[model samples]
Target: MPDLSLLDIVNLCDNCRVHQPDPVPSPYDSERLVPFYLSESPDSPVIGLLRPVIVEQLKLENQRSRDSGQRELWALNVDESNFVSRRNRPSGPSVSFRDWLDTHTKRTVAMKELCERWRDTLLFEDVCGPKKWREELYPVYADPFGVHDHPNTAAPGQATNFVFEMERSACALFGVVTYGVHMTIYDEVEVDGEKTLRVWVPTRALSKPTFPGMLDNTVAGGIGSGMSVFETLVKECMEEASIPEHVVRKYTRASGAVSYFYRTSKGWLQPEVEYVYELAIPAGVDPQLFEPRPSDGEVESFELLTHTETIRKMRQGLFKPNCALVLLNLYIRLGYVTPDDEPDYMKILTRLHGTFDFERW
Candidate 1:
């Protein structure tokens, strides 16, 4: 098969932008998706986009919890509608999933309890089952906009303006946007009097729960609940690639970020933003010192591939989906892929930096 184009790679990550009409139209069926709100007020900001199945499950769980004399973690407000048309059509419930948790207990504790209960029960077994559960907690911001600017120095429950923290595994169930950091470590060398670029790429451990045995960025990991972007980058570098803190601080450059809404083959929503960074080993440095070795079991091994070979592997779909996007962004930034060569230059650039401004959706 021919190598995939840059546009094809972009489409792989930003796959869920198109809106599909509900086939069995109901009163709630319209252009907009069910928005998960931070509060009960109609004016509250939407923190997530809930799928139909997830919406139904949340409503059922809310009713069940209330019937059992337990505090309902979520409140369904059917009175207010966010639908485009108000022609006597009963709109879908505006779910205030975090408000009750925020009021009753510390959001951090409440969300943990809620997720633990769901994990124990049969609810969302496909995604939130014990086997699939990732014990790591991810923060949910009340206002996710401009959150990257804030330092990750806050405690578990005290991220800047964050509403709550949820289990990383269960985040897809709520369709919330998640944040992570991705870094590309590369080097430039002169071969046969010609300049050449080579990148350090790691193969994911086969034991990994997701995307096992696929190629990945040199250092990449999700920003845990209380960790900042750079902090996560540094931690993942050492943990995954055995790169030390001083090496990371000296070589890493904070590149721009990429955002995309992805739907898994299992039909789970993952709206994600990855803060991108690049670590370039300066010329004349001993390659052995900056070389990546698998420190943690997360990476099976590391390989340094030439620019042509790296793009070939990417085009062949060897890398994890989002990791490929990070590399694509790298190629563009380093001038390997440019407007003069790639036909869909503008389109590729636009999709890579998706606004993620859901109001227009």
Candidate 2:
């Protein structure tokens, strides 16, 4: 196969951006999705985007619950064309999605039960096939652009801007913006008296559900509900790479984040944000101290590759789509990919941070 250009690598992650006219044209747009609202109020925030199939399923579920004299979980406002949490009480006003989940005593339990029930259905099998079921819950943030603060707060929902938690497997089904942390760990070494960086990259375990046997970042994991970015980073470092907390805390530096709207091959929407980090080990430090070993079955093995080799593999499509994006961001930050050499430098930079603003949808 021919080598992919740097822009091609970026396009792989942010492929949705390459498709024009925003909302997508009809006939060919069977995957056009609708915004999911927190409440029936016009001002309520859009917490997710829902594909037509999922929306139809939800509508049917709502009808069935209402017909059986059970509480309807969702309210479909025809006038506004959005889905919201149905008012549980007849006398009281409708509650926001966050309040409904938090006060109903179920919290995230209701959603979990729903997913479990759907696990046996054809719709579930189609949207999130067997290989994609992560059995993990990912938080849905109300304010997508807001800061995720109060990481250590004792209160259940006070720590972050999350409204509710859904199965990670079903996130793409709901078209929610999922958050994760990716750390590129590398060592600066002197080669013939010149400083060069060698990065540690991992191959995903073949038994893994998604992107099995694909190249991945040194350490990466989703930020589960109630977990802070740093907390998730430290945990992933140890769990995925066997790198202890102290080494991570000392060497890892926050290197901003990459946001992009991606559509899976199955046509499911995935608007995601990956918090990027860099772990730089100085030239004189013992290499063995910072080296990564696969402690979790999620990774097959770890390999240290030079900068050139890393870029070559990336261009060859050896890396997972988003992982390649993280590597591209790393190269840009390290001064290896710049405006002078890369003609699409500005375009690449903008698309790297392509926030899926609701208005654009």
Candidate 3:
């Protein structure tokens, strides 16, 4: 979602007033009531709702949404400032960080132990450590322990350009993240008459969520929604495929962002950013069967799709919208299809006519 400030909304409302008739009072009329309302926050029942409402309305107006014209309404009844953590608290009595670490290091399950130890070490009993404390743990647990830093830290000099949409009652903006991945396999197999290459996608899972914004969007500490493309891929690989570190770190052909899209969610067309990456699996190993995931309860089933099969599935709308774009881009990269290498849809639509871009929620 895009963000807007109160002044921005005032200017917009002013513009709306110019083109359309003022029905009741100016939307900014509440601005005049804020100072008085805040003064009575201690006991005024009306002040409790009214003061936060004014501030939140301003926040909503400033927020980035898919719809520019309608995003203002999200302010209506939202207790925007009351964000609470849904994380499960530790069971049993709290212990010192060092004590927790001593206990966790003996545990057999590495990921859970590490996470519990980390939470206790970082957030328990006022560690009083600087934000940079996370950097110390990065090398220790980042990949192997599933305690990795998110790609929320954008590289210096990088800037984001937003895509905005307006709905009847709300609006949002599209934000993109640059992402890359490489897949490779090496093994020997018999060809027509002699030993030959059996190039295949070595990844165990074919359809796991990879993009960032597809899951969560709350911007924290300068990180916006759709910020963790690499992290998301890493997470998916870990949970769905059990891909090892050596395999993930293996160098192979790196495909730049081939293309991307935003599927407007249904009902008011809430906006969402989407991204795609393509990589070739080097010749040799046999493709692995993806086991159905239990930790990630949402995974249905996984299957390997050949280049031809993947394209057919994309064309048939059998894939999720983001997954479809990923498959289409993968097809183009593998020479199963050709695209203009531009991000715009019309160019590709012109090249491959009678196509459909699936709308996702």
Ranking by TM-score: 1, 2, 3
Q: Top model by TM-score, which number?
A: 1
For each of the candidates, give the backbone clash count. 0, 0, 24
Q: Stretches of candidate 2 above 4 Å error?
A: 17-30, 78-107, 126-131, 149-160, 190-195
> For residues 238-303, could you state the per-residue lDDT of candidate 1 as single tens digits?
899988899999988998998987767666778899999998988777777789999879999999
C-alpha local distance difference test of each model: 0.77, 0.76, 0.28
Best by lDDT: 1
Minimum summed lDDT over a 10-residue window in model 1 is located at 22-31
Model 2: ten consecutive residues of lowest lDDT: 87-96
- C-alpha RMSD by candidate, in order: 4.5, 5.0, 19.0
lDDT by residue (1-361, candidate 2, tens digit) is: 5799888888777766322433323332544456676765546666777766777777788788889997777755433433333323112122234334443226367777677777756457855555567777788766887866433454765545656677888888777789999999887667899867789999999998778899999999998877889999999999999998999998889999999887776677789999999989866778788889999799989999988898899889898999999988898888878899999999889888987755544
Candidate 1: misplaced stretches above 4 Å? 18-32, 78-93, 98-100, 103-105, 148-159
- Score candidate 2 by TM-score against the native: 0.87
* TM-score against truth, every candidate: 0.88, 0.87, 0.36
